[model samples]
Target: MNGDWLLRGRDGRLSVYQSSGDAVLCRVERAPGGPWDEPRKVGGEQRLLPVLAVGQGADRYAHLVAWRPTVQGEAGLVHSTHFRARLAALDWNPVGHPNKKGDRTGTPAVAVDAEGRAHVFVRNKGGGVSMLAQKEKGGWEPWQDIRGKGVQDGLAAVTGESGRVELYAAVPEGLLYWRQEEPGARPVLKESLKAPVRPGTLYALATSPASTTLYYTGTGGELWAWRPGGEPVALLPSAGHGPVAAVRCELDGHDCTLLAQRSASGRVAFAAYPTELESAGAWWTESGPQLTVDARVSLGTDEDGRVVAATLSPSTGTLLLTRRKDEPGLALEAWRAV
Candidate 1:
């Protein structure tokens, strides 16, 4: 998948997961330095689609989910989480196959609540939403239907700043939202939000303890940010054509929001602005070697909580990594291939 290729373990080591052909390959960071272990096959063979990995809660267990074709009109969703410990890629667990024919099942998106339960949500065949949650006893509940018609295929989910799981689906009109009344509770659908969000470009990040921001590319190619109670703020001097990899970190002594996207020119474009201040402004700078526009960009923190971002070049099959330098601003060390 052109999403979430990087995962940070509890010990702050990172693993980069990618599907090379039908197998899932993983490369682990041996230590904090630039040296990395070679990529090894982690997942078995299947007619797989895009892969997604979500790390959540204090344990920060990363749950990897992938969809693969089975029989006619039937498909399977599989999951894998911490095996032995963090940075270990082991076995795959089944989430059952759904056999809804004709209108094929949509792609899967996943998030974990404060207690570290995986809640898998997808667009059902009828154009509405359905969800499955991981039980405390380590099994999945039967898929439950959450009503929201005309939902587009790509869905964005996040464990919100409040520790409640929230989901967003884009319809033709605007955004359909679902949020839990409390942590570990089922997310209830809220009234539709009005925006011209482009599909496959919607992602949410908790930029602060009190604020979670929604970022997306607009129908007119502009980038927009919206919070729960504010207008959709268009980012100035936008230059990307896809979703963004975002993080909140202290740049020197000031809090900043860092964003990275694959610019239209096929390079990793990045910038950082003061957190929650769009009008204050930031500019886009392209970095690294030229990669495809759909190349996945990911962000996480090192053992010391310094920011790190990475991307893989399909053309050369090399993992390109960068890190936040110990400077007064959001400066980065040179991009290196591993």
Candidate 2:
């Protein structure tokens, strides 16, 4: 449904609001895949930004992360939690809590592997990047510094078809990747790409399931793609002036498209490439009329191969949803009327 918004809490609480701003659904849980038992109010006077990720399963579970402010002027810390639909639970359990001093940590990006392990990537205020993982039997693992120093962007995780966990982070120097074959072992640096980087800047990265091609946008607004044996190919010709967000998904069962959003004017764009054209060395073609959208749009896909774009209205602070049409010309249909 377009315009309908879902808000999640740091403690793994979920509240679904109707298009008319009515609270229609709510739940709480200890973990995403869990037997949820507790329920409580999401206490806070200030607005909290909720980031959620669907786990790797046929019946996907939603994991949430958020940052809250403390009573003092200092910003509250980041927290991790999860929820699932089967149990109809909405309470969020804190996998990890923030430091008591409360110096302002940012929200975390979450991912769950095939084994149901949770991986969190967080950017500390001091410009350091750390990753935390939770094993099945073991509790929270010690936070590992992915980027020892410098600001990071475009952190993402995807469970490869081979069952290996792939993590990507874009730093000031370039893009960095890490992989782990099994638990209790360090994640090895699989690859790194040297490219122009900028601190406090955001870039989008996604790997094709079929080809494992890593795609990203530079600070200069140019789109680039990297494969195993091939050089990085520049997809977009002209550069723009703002951050880029992208999601990789199949289109019409034939084309693999990278749906990206430009910040300069809040326009949604698409870069469609034939999945069968993986080794053909074909260039990425861009197409879009640049629709007006809220600045905070999140890109995702549904089970039926439909692209879903969610954003919160800056003015009314309402959530909006839009879906890409299943037609042949790469059109988009706004399910939620702005």
Clashes of each: 0, 10
Instruction: Please state the error at residue 170 of candidate 2 in Å.
Output: 2.9
Candidate 2: worst-modelled 10 consecutive residues by lDDT: 17-26
RMSD of 1: 2.3
Candidate 2 stretches with Cα past 4 Å from truth are 1-59, 70-82, 85-90, 95-102, 105-107, 124-128, 198-213, 227-230, 237-248, 252-255, 276-294
Give the alpha carbon lDDT tens digit for every residue of 1-338 in model 2: 21112333334333332211211222333453233333223322334434333233222444444444445665532333334332434433444433334544654556566666767666665666666777678667776765534546445555555545666667678866677757434466667777875432343233554335555666676656656345766666323443344555766666565545444545444456654244444333333334345344456555455666655444454444566787865577753632
Report, for every candidate in turn, its global Cα lDDT versus the true structure.
0.75, 0.49
Best by lDDT: 1
Each model's RMSD to truth, in Å? 2.3, 7.4
Per-residue alpha-carbon lDDT of candidate 1 for residues 59-147, written as tens digits (9 for 90 to 100):
66767777766677566777777541224564676676443433247777888887778888888877888888988777887878888
